[model samples]
Target: MRRLIAVALAVVLLVAGCTRNSDGAADVQVGGDPGASPTLRFRAPLTVTEPSSTVVWAGTGSALVEGKPVLIDYWLENAETGAVVAESYTTSPKPYLLTKESLGTDLFAALRGQRVGARIVEVSPASAARGMTFPTVIVMDVLATRAEGDPVPARPGMPIVTLAADGAPTITPTTTTPPTDLTVVPLIKGTGDQVPTGAEVTIQYTEVDWATGAVVDSTWSTGLPVSFSLAGLGAWSQGLVEQTVGSQVMVVVPPSFGLGGPAGSELQSATLVFVVDILAATKPTAPVSPPVTIAPSTAPSSSPTS
Candidate 1:
């Protein structure tokens, strides 16, 4: 299993390096019948008819994937080796939040809106293709793509805020401030990062009911971060992305928390104060890759009148 994972990940890095962006995330490289170079391949067996964002490959003019935040089922096969690389099958689409580039789980990688259904076979064990080592072929399929996300903006650096889930405490931002409520204190001031559209984050906070003038739920998260997303998540954590992570937060929620258990159901609405630590944080920033442009096509014709 590890062997397959290693090979698949290697091919992905190779494929990514061979590709670059032009103009920005707005304009990406796509398919065209142009001069072939040792650096790139103009043809791809798998393709996307239409592209969503600037995040597209330069190889084929067609879209390789779809949706802003895409999820895919990917598989890698050795082009020459004829080996199956890796496999991931789940109902919920594994988002290919392929920001600038991905971090971990290289073996199972995907672009937005497209999933490599199954990575089957490996051709090049480490041979140079166009001077770069790339698996001759990779097998993938798109599982799902839509206008859904974790509800975070495209930001980097700083901290991020991810909402909570059911059986857990619920928090909401009030239109006005409550004097008897807790206030978050930030060490520094920055715009903050963007949480993955569907990331579960833990928070340490305090909650005080205005009516009681007493601290109610002033406890930290027992579990890792609560799982939530802007795409599929409901009720809780809906509008959290509006605020930046690392910054202090003041919110209101029910006094009782389920903690994933049946007990602790004292539902009371009050302003909760928190200094949230956005796990897997991201900040708004620009892509580092340079933009590219293709030679413009020209028509040739001439006529003489006598």
Candidate 2:
């Protein structure tokens, strides 16, 4: 029999660089707002005395929090040659879920507590570059933090859910019989932005069978949350849409929503339960432009008046 667990985790883009230094003048000068691309000005072949970072400008918006998604635009250049090694300016700003696993300690520390719209300049020695050929100077702009959605009311007669200090949920079912229709209850109300329909969401979840009360699968055991498009999730898609970041939800699905359909397995007719914590959500992709078409011009010739 197939299990009903769906684990989708966000892909972390690891950028290697050096440590951050305070109380020192920047060898590389930088300019730009958090909303636009960055402009780096420095002497090519600039020598780095030590690893350090400087907040060229502080953002006046919301402060950044760890373990959440942050949108950032950055440009990395070789200190010696001033050549561009990497950048996200030409494309969309990248979403980074800040963690030691996803980013280096230095880069993660440098971004901690930074506000949306803040710009920073960082210098790292070759040693900090993880044996790269040249030292690096990276200019970054903090664009925005992921929005947390609004809260929903908890439903009655559902399973009781409690969280551990570390944020793992324990589900205790109330009734023996499974629910006939889809049942969704919001246990915790989040005050952040509302999650848009079909947005890609990062979450940790657990699935269990109502009959046996056995956990089919859980993302917590993997030690990290997963990412998936809400629209892509067939059975597990209802309670997540429009949920807020940092909010926990409980969903009860009938056999039709469970994997394998009704004829596939005995458990396919069994009720499925899920507890989900929405960590973050990504912005939808921009709409593409339609193809251009050319047409012949229609005109009349002019005659000279005598």
Candidate 3:
């Protein structure tokens, strides 16, 4: 079991995006709004003598840059079998950091210069995609692109916040004493949509123990933001509510509201400091009707994990 898990993880990390499909490309047809999820239809036995891609719809939003996190809704079909291989339209769109190492070869090739809100159709021959016997047809909708949010002014008495060129934050302790009350500081003021309670939010954060000034954890080290719903994050939800996406914030939580326990226990007593950058916010999408369970794809993909 452990070996199987490890192999699966290796596959996910190293080859999630392989070829578009296994066989020769067949006829590919796509129709839908560029801003929303589009429809994918293609005849079986599609033949792609060579790899091909087309932008069915062009969005007016910002163009996507390589190495940035991107959110997308997608559908994959096996042209030979006429099957829905893997899809996110029935569930939720997935987020992927747009790097060659993380995306499938064909997907990365197809989306390099596309703008947010574009709909793309791509066909990959079996020769290009691995582990397939038929050509694959893929349709994708680019939803949003992650950006380094606006820069905010400094606040006195809070931890000093500085950013690397890529938006990762370096937090330094300014004072030895921890605050007794909750302190919310907006380090970078963003212009994006306000984050609502229970919405899924993507953020890069570093946490430290206030009393000892020791680092607890951080997402900055990985260079990828983590996303979660704010429903049960306790003080996190309180501090982040009403903050706009792309804002960098400093949240100081007392034990009672932050960790929840006696006031003096080592774990509960120490004030916690979190330096967070709100990169994006999305609400839970309504589920599509008559949900379809598509078979997992042979192609490598980095769509959002359920």
Per-prediction TM-score to the true structure, in the order listed: 0.27, 0.57, 0.63
Per-residue accuracy of model 3 over 177-218 as CA lDDT, tens digit each: 777887899877877779887776766677877656577777
The per-residue C-alpha lDDT of model 3 at residue 191 equals 74
Task: State the lDDT of candidate 2 residue by residue for 1-306, as single tens digits.
Answer: 000000111111122233223433334546554445566666567766566566677787678778865556567767788877666454334455666545566667778888876777676656622645566777677754322345456566676666664456777766756678878777766654567776666566777776666777676564445555566564555667777765777878777664524366656677777887765565556423221111111110110011
Model 1: per-residue Cα lDDT over 8-80, one tens digit each: 2212213334432232221112222211111212233222221112212332212333213223333343333
For every model in order, what is the number of clashing pairs? 52, 13, 16
Ranking by lDDT: 3, 2, 1
Ranking by TM-score: 3, 2, 1
- lDDT against the true structure, per candidate, is 0.29, 0.57, 0.60
Q: Identify the leading candidate in terms of lDDT.
A: 3
Report the error of model 3 at residue 270, Å. Answer: 2.1
Model 2 whole-model lDDT (C-alpha atoms): 0.57
